[model samples]
Target: MTKKLFWEDPYLSTFTSSVISVEENENWPGKFLVVLDETGFYPEGGGQPWDEGNIGDGYVSYVFIKDGVIYHVVDQDPGKGAIQKCRIDWDRRFDFMQQHLGQHILSSVFEKHHNAETVGFHLGTETVTIDLTMDSISDEELQKVELEANNQIYKNLKVQSLFPSVEGLKELPLRKQPTTDEDIRIIEIKDYDYSPCGGTHPAYTGEVGMVKVRKWEKVRGNIRIEFACGLRALKDFIWKNQQINSISALLSLKDVEAYEGTERIYRELRDLNKKYNQQSRLLLEYQVKEYHREAEEYQGISLVSLVFEDKDMKQLQTLAAALNQYPNTVALLAAKGDKAQVVFTRSKDLSLDISKLFKEVIGLIDGKGGGNPITAQGGGDNVANLQGLMDAAVIKLKHEYVK
Candidate 1:
């Protein structure tokens, strides 16, 4: 069995060890696993990701434990039977340590205060999430849980990892039962929290630095609470303050009053949008009347063809519907924005399949969209040739219907 140096001292980031074996990893091609007689690289386990660092000159891409051995998968081979310098990424290792410890305190606090047992945990790169068996948690209750956990951190309690014999374990009051009967490693956070964990951790509660509960959501009858800890907590704090400062400056308000100022701005924008929409509708109504006056009749078919600047597809549909109100009328409208949109519609009295005709027209510009016969709409990159597209569609109509 390999010597578990990490369990011995996770703080030991750098060490020199003899490579016991070297084998090409079958799962990940081109990479090789250099097994050291002892290593401090914590392998991926217990909802915690693996540690990565340098194994000699090569990169320690991944680490995993199987059958009581630490396999350091390296990018470049560091031959067998050679003493190689191994260093764990201390920043990453310490970050995970902080998050892992934070999880324990948070979990213990929830159990003690609310009797909400943690069913799952994930120490993610961005956030650490703990899933509780409870179906729901109120805002007030969640705040209390967060307060309790941070208080634990503030207390700076001594955290101990003890290996107790099967007989000795019966006397300890563990917050949770150990899953494994043998080699039981118990992590006790002073008198506050006690649980079984094989993962690495800091020696004291203060080392966890701080913890913050960001948000929570319901998942399959469980509450998944997302949070950040240690460096992550500090990072989140910095980012939020920066954003608040920017908003406050733009709104000409104090930092604390930024929220109120933002809300006021939102209301003003809403009112402006409402007024803009009313004016646009009135304009479209006037435009439809002009179309009715200029409508051209061919073989008793009243055709209204027009194009507009920057009008959306919704406006095109509205204009088409207005023209269809008249008998035997066909509305062919196009709007130009980044692209050219063409809409074709006919009254129920007409026998035109605009969907098929629109499909053939859009092929000229390599564009895409479709609709049924009564109303068909599509757009293409032919912004400059909006008039040309209209002329082509009108010619196709004249060839089929107007002799």
Candidate 2:
């Protein structure tokens, strides 16, 4: 079995290790299977990313483990006999170490204070998440845990790793039972925590620096807490402060007053919308009165023909419905805006085939429409053809209805 160097020194970024094996695997192309006696490259497992860097002069693309043997998948073969110089990206390695260590401390505190077991864990790019066995944890209780975790950080507690036998592990107080059978690697944070973890972690609590619970939510009868530590926490703080300043300026309000200002603006907009709707209704009512006065009574029918300038389709529909009370009347309404709209309606006896008439009339203006036989509505982007539309409607009415 290949020795895991990360467990000994999580901060070790570079090391010299002898290659134990080199083989070609069908699964990976242009890559060699490099097994080293010792390595600092943490394999991609336990929700943490694999360590990326160089082995000798070649770049290591992927680090994986098979049957307890860690393999460095590199770009070029460093030869089997040569001692490869392995180097890891120290910034990423240390950040992960801090997060992992912080999780151990925080998880320990949760189990100690509330008897909540750490059901799940995930180490992400920005933060680490720990799922508690309980359904919920209030904000006040979460703050207390955060305060306690940071206080432990200030103590500079010693974090030691020990390879204990199954019998030896039985004597120690572990937060969670060990899953492995070979040899349990127990990480102890002084008197605060003891857990069996194979992942790399900080040597001391002070190295973790800080732990901040950024957010939390309940999931599957458990509470998942998302947190950041060390450099990640510092970056998150800087980004959040910048966002607050930007929002304050864009809203033209003090940082403390920004949220209230936004709410006030939303309420004003809603009130304005109500006033606009009332005004539109009144305008449509006035237009309908004018249309009734100008209509000519023909053959026991009120023939209302109107031409409106810069009117919308909604106003036209309102006018059509308002004139519906006139028995045996034919109402022809037209409006000119970005487009020209025509609405034709007739009372009971005069069954105007508007769908057929629209197809013919719309062809002249390159438009399209569909409606019931008694009342039809059609429109086109030919605003200049407003007069033409009125003329066509009159001609079509004379030809189709004035029999």
Candidate 3:
């Protein structure tokens, strides 16, 4: 078995290690999995990502462990002969350490305080998450968790990792049982929490910087809380503050007053939208009056047809419905834009198949829609030929109904 140097000193970023073996990769040309006698790099496991750095003359792109041997997946093959210097990316290793420790602290708080069990965990590059065994956690409860987690950091409590015997583990008050009974590593936060974890961690809780629960969502009958800590939490806070400052300046309000100011503007926009809708309806009603006057008489029935530019579908419905007051009239209208929209409607007295007429005319522009015998609306790509399509429909209706 390879010596796990990281377990001895997680702070060691550089080391000298002899190559135990080098296996050439057939799938990835110019790549090799090199096994070392000892290593400081952490493998991707237990919700924490793998540590990245360089070994020998090539870049250490990946790291993994299999059958008690730690493999340094390198881009270039380092000949298996002598000792080589191994380097660990402290930024990445420490970040994961902070995040992993932060998760331990957070899950413990939720479990200890609210009796919520963390059933799932994922330590991502942008955010870390833990699925709590709860349907939902209220804002008030989450706030309390956040406050206490940060307080733990402020307390600067020592964090110890203990490897308890298989038989002795039964005595410890573990937050949760370990997956494997062989090697159970328990993390103890002094006067705070004791939980089983395989991932690395900082020496003290203060190194976690800050633990912030950003948001939560319901998933798999539980609440998944998305959070961040250390440098990631700092970055998030900086970005959010920048955005808030920009919004506050644009609203001509102080940082504290920005929310209320934005809410006021949003409410104003809603009122304006409602007022515009009312005025638009009145304008469409007047336009329908003008269209009714221009109707052509055929077989004692008025045929009102017109082509409008960029009119809404609702306007067409309202116009068609308003024109329906005329005893025996048919309304064939089109609104032109990138595409053409046509509406066909008749008064209650005329039991004509406007849907059939619409289907046929709409085919000229290759469009599809549907409605009953009295009213129908459709759209087509042939906007330029909208008037011609309406003329054809009107002529066909006249030939059929005209006496």
Candidate 4:
């Protein structure tokens, strides 16, 4: 069994130890697994990531444990030597320590105040999240938990890691029971909290700096709280402050007034859009009247077949519906811009199956569409042939059905 030097001195950055064993990692090519007599590198376990740094000449990329043995995945094979130097990346290690401890304090607060249990935890690169037993929590209630968690951090209570005997475990009020009975490791947060954990943590709660719940959402009948601690929380604050300042300057409002100012601007834009749509509808009605007047009459059927430039398919459908309101009228419309489009419709008084005629014409433009006998619409990339497609529809109607 390898000695866990990390448990002895979590802050130990550099140490010398013998390279006890070396083996090629079967799963990772060009990588070697090196085991030392003692190590400060924390293996990936307990919802905490593995510590990465240097082992002799090799860069340690990942660390893991298999059947009670810790393995360090190295980029290069640290040669056969009696003693090799190992160094822990302190920044990465301490950041994880802060987040891990912050989770303990926050979880304890949730349990104490709301009678909620922490069902899951994930320490991500950008944020840490804890899944709680409760399905929902009010903002005011969450604010209380956040304030209490930060209060514990400010108190700077002593954090202790204990290896208590199985019999001795009955005396402490642990937040949760350990999964294993043998060799149980417990983390006690002074008088605040106690729980079984193998993850590394700082000596004092103050090292966590602060605990801020960024947001929360319900997931699988539980509430998942996304949070940040210490440096991560500080970085989050800086980014949000910059955004607020930029918005305030742009709107000529104070930081506190930015929300209201943005809301007002959104309302004005929505109202303007409503007015523009009204005016556009009025213009389309007038254009429809002009097109109806110019329609050609063949055998008592008014054929409103026309091609427009840069017109949207929605507008074409609206025009077809309007023209179909007239007696014994058929609207065959096409538009050309980035693509060719066709819309065909007939009045309720007529029994012309325009869908069949629509199919024959839209195929000229390599388009696909379907509709009932009264209306059909489609578009294709053959914009240059859109007018020809419209004319084909008129001929198909006059020859096949209008007769």
List model 3 lDDT by residue over 1-403, tens digit each: 8888888888899999898888888865788989888999888788888889988878998888888778888987677876898889999999999999999999999998999999999998777899999988889988999998999999999998899887778878889999886767889899788888878899999999999989999998999999999999989999999999999999999999999999999999999999999998888778877788888888798898888886867777878889988889899888988778888999888877888888778888777898998898889887777878988998889986544
Residue 253 in candidate 1 has what lDDT? 94
Worst 10 residues of 4 by lDDT: 76-85
Order of quality (lDDT): 4, 1, 3, 2
* Superposed model 2: Cα runs more than 4 Å off: 23-27, 249-403
C-alpha lDDT (0 to 100) for residue 297 of candidate 1: 82
After superposition, the stretches of candidate 3 with alpha carbons farther than 4 Å from their true spots are 15-37, 54-86, 134-140, 218-221, 282-286, 312-329, 345-382, 400-403
- TM-score per candidate, chains pooled: 0.93, 0.72, 0.81, 0.86
TM-score, structure 3 vs. true: 0.81
| Superior candidate under TM-score, 1 versus 4 | 1
Residues 82-189 of candidate 4: C-alpha lDDT, one tens digit per residue: 688888899999999999999999999999999999999999778899999997999999999999999999999999889988778999999999998676999999
Question: Model 2, 282: alpha-carbon shift in Å?
Answer: 6.9
RMSD of each: 2.1, 5.7, 3.8, 3.1
Per-residue lDDT over 170-259 for candidate 1, one digit per residue giving the tens place of the 0 to 100 score: 888888898877778999899887789989999999999888999999999989999999999999999999999999999899999999
What lDDT score goes with residue 157 in model 2?
A: 98
Cα deviation of 53 in candidate 2 (Å)?
1.2
Better of 2 and 4 by lDDT: 4
lDDT of 3: 0.87
Worst 10 residues of 3 by lDDT: 394-403
